[model samples]
Target: MSPFNNTTFTHAVFLLTGIPGKEDVYLWITIPFCLVYVISILGNSLILFVIKTDSSLHEPMFIFLSMLAVADLGLSIATIPTILGVFLFNSREIGVNGCFAQLFFIHFSQFTESSVLLFMAFDRLVAISNPLRYTSILTLPRIAIMGLVCVLRGFALILPLPLLLKRYRYCQDNVLSHSYCLHQEVMKLACADITVNNIYGLAISILTMGLDSLLIFISYVMILKTVLSIASREECLKALKTCGSHLCIVLLFYSPEISLSVTHRFMHSSSHLLQIILGYIYMLVPPLMNPIVYSVQSTHLRVRLIRLFVK
Candidate 1:
C-alpha cells in the first residue's frame, strides 16, 4: 500500500533528496533554508504591506512590484515544504499526484515570475520613455488585466505537464536531485517514451522563459538608449536610476538561470554538488535578494520602512 510500491503505477512516488552529496549535513543545511524562507516570507510580506497601506505607492511600478512579491512568495511556498521535510524530518517520499502538483506549482511560479519581470521591464520603459503618458496608460484596470494575464499564462503553459507525465509510467528509482519537483526532473525518470513530453517542455521554456528574457533585454536596451539621450547628465542618471533595482533584479533572476542551463548542457561532467549549489542559487537567491535590492535602491521605500519600524 506504500506509494513507493513498485507494482502500481498510480502509486508511484519520487524520493526528494535535499542535497545529493551532503546528506550528513542536513542539519546544518536547514539553517540556510530556514533563513531563506523567513526572508522570502517577511520581506515579500513587508513589500505587500507597505504597498497596500500607502496610497502614494499604488502606481503601476509598485503595483507590478506587489505582483512580483506574490510570485516570489508562491515560489518559496512551493519548495519550502519538501525542503523542510528533507532537511528536518527525513521525509523524502512524494506520491504521484503530489509530485505532479509540486512540479506544476514550481514551473507555474517560475513562468509567472518571468512574465512579471517582462512586464516590469515594460513598466520601466514606459515610465522612462514617456512619463507623462505612463499613468494614463497603465491604469488600475489595465494593471489588473495584466496581472490576470500573468496568472493565466503561468497556468496555461504548465497545465499540460501533469497530464503528459501521467501518460507514462516511471520505473526508475524515482529519486530527484533536489528537494523540489521539477517537470524535467520527473520526466526523466519515466519508463515510457517521453519524446512528446521532452519536446513540449523545451518548447514551453523557449516560448515562455526564452521569449520573455529576450523581450526584457530589448526593453532595457531601449530604456538605456532613451536614458542616454537626456541632455543633462543628472537627468540621464535619474532616468537610469529608476531602473537600478529592476536592472539588478533582471540580472539576479536570469543570469544564474542561464548559467545553470549552460552548465547542464555543456558541463554535465562537472561536480553534482556544484549543480545542486547552482540550483539553490537559481531558486532561493532571488527571493532572498529582491527585497534588499528594492529597499536599497528606492528612497521612498526605505523611508517608509524606517517610519514603519520607528513606530
Candidate 2:
C-alpha cells in the first residue's frame, strides 16, 4: 500500500538518510556525533545554571548569553533524536507530523539564535558607546521583553511552513538528503510547483538572518568608532576586550551558516556528502563550541566556572 495519501495530496512518511555510503561504519560515526551532542547539552545547561544561580551574572551580557544558550539547547535537542536514531538504531523512518515538528523547532531555534546574537551586538555597542547608561537603558524587564520578542518573531515566521508544505503532493520517493527534515529539503520532493514555498522561505531567511547579520555588522562598526575615540589606551583595550568573546561567537555561528546556505542554494552540483557534512556542522558546531568560547574568553564567566569547579 502507498504510504502517501493521494486524495489528501500529502506524504504520510519520509525516509531519512545517514552518512551517504558510510553505512558500514555507522558505529564509528555515532561516536563523534554522540560526543558532540553530549558536550553541547552539558555545556549549555551549565551556562544556564550558572547564570540563573549567580546574582552577579544577571547583567545584560550574560542575560543575552543565557538566551543564546537556550537556543543552542533547543537546536541540539531538535536534531539529536533523528541523528542518533539514524546512526545508533538505523531508524530512518519519520512520520510527516514528526518531520514537520522537527523542522519547525530547528528553524525556530536558528532564527531565535540569530535574533539573540543581534541583540547581543547591540548590548556590546551600548556598553562601549555609553557605559554610564548601559544598566539604565537595558533593564531586566526590557531585556526580558526583547527575549520574548525574539521567540515570538521566530514563531510567527516559521509557523506557516508546514501548512504551506502540506498543500503539495510528493510523488517521488520521500527520501531526505539529511538525517532530519528541513523545509527546503522537504519542499524539493513535492510534485507541484513550490514557488510560494521557495519565495516565502527565501523571504524569511533574507529578512531575519540576513538583516540581522547586516545590523550586527553595523553595531560593531559603531562599537569600533566608540572604542577608537577613547582617550586612554587602557580604556580602549578594555572596551575591545569586552567584545572579543562575542565576536568569536558571531563568527562561529554565521560563518558556516552562510556557507551552508550558499552551498545549498548555489552549489547544486557540489558533492552530496559535502552538503550533508555542512548541514551537520551548521547545526552542531555553534552549540558545541559556544560555551567553550565563552568560558575561555569572558573573564567573569571563566572565574565563575573556576570557582564552581574548585569548590
Error of 1 at 308 (Å): 1.3
Q: Residue pairs in steric clash, candidate 2?
A: none
Candidate 1, clashing residue pairs? none
Model 2: per-residue lDDT, tens digit, 1-311? 45664645443788899898899999998989999999999999999999999999999999999999999999999998789999999999998788888999999999999999999999999988888999999999999999999999999999999989877777767789999989989999888899999999999999999999999999999999989999999999998999998899899889888888888888899999888988998999999999999999998998998898998
Q: Which stretches of candidate 2 lie over 4 Å from their true place?
A: 5-11
lDDT of 2: 0.92
Model 1 stretches with alpha carbons more than 4 Å out: 1-6
Q: What lDDT score goes with residue 51 in model 2?
A: 93
- Total backbone clashes of candidate 2, pairs 3 or more residues apart or in separate chains: 0
lDDT of 1 at 65: 89
